[model samples]
Target: MVTTWFKKFMGKRLFDRYYKFEKMLPVFAIGDRFCVTHAEPKTHYSEKDIVNALVNREIIFNLTWTDNGQAEIGSVVRYLYDFFPDNQEARMFGGHRPIPISQNYLSRAGGKYIQIHNPSWYNIVYVRDMKDFLIYRDIFSILPLAERLAKKEEI
Candidate 1:
């Protein structure tokens, strides 16, 4: 089953990160492979703030519909833009698009992620999120993050 394969992948991928658990929990795969933190979300950030958040940042996104089971529950793409970047322009998976995530969402991205309202768009050339993606310090170490997660908790 794909479930077994995903667990294997996540285990190997997260091995160097977190402390081991007595019993391994089940990990879920949806949207894409990204980090999920415990930061707080901001439902009311000023327009100026968001604009500044995504300036000069190139994003990388492997989008799929929320229509499927993977679509709705797992919405935001949670990756460390600076998970291992050594330059100003971070390695993003997608361009900046307007995201309206709940504060719960922001916290998961460590308040470092931007929610994409309509993530179904294919080619996001010259978008807003590309500009202000500077949360370098917020980028978590995989090992530490893994230490925080023994198994996939859910979306």
Candidate 2:
């Protein structure tokens, strides 16, 4: 109950902060600088899955781009949240899903803002029923690798 209300309140605030009417469409310039990546979860994945899969710990603190030595290249971040939220993540704002909260987490972790697109990583939409089970409503924030390690050093 309280969590739902808080989520809605924050969602409204975020919308007001980012929404803009430049032409016939709304624009939210995620950040001055951002990264992009694609998620290929065989099942309904969560924050941990994303962290384990995409974050290139071997790359040190590189947050902008990486050459994975695979087909993927450029505009990749050292963390998942560093990539701006997709249209679905944005549309699902105010929910308790990790993806929604992850977007907010990015901002708190010194990310400039968020971006919806990067030509380097074209958006790929997941079919509505990708997973059989319903994802539970819950808020989660996974800090970027760089920020997490920095906090540990501070301790």
Which window of 10 residues has the lowest lDDT sum in candidate 2? 88-97
Q: What lDDT would each prediction earn against the true structure?
A: 0.29, 0.28
TM-score of each: 0.19, 0.15
lDDT of 2 by residue, 49-150 (tens): 434533433321232222222213222222233333432232111111123312422122222212222222222222233222122322222234446676
* Candidate 1 residue 138 C-alpha distance from true site, Å: 20
Query: How many Å off is the CA of 74 in candidate 1?
Result: 15
Give the residue spans of candidate 1 off by over 4 A.
Answer: 1-84, 87-108, 118-155
Lowest summed lDDT window (length 10), candidate 1? 59-68
Clashing pairs in 2: 30-113, 30-114
Best by lDDT: 1
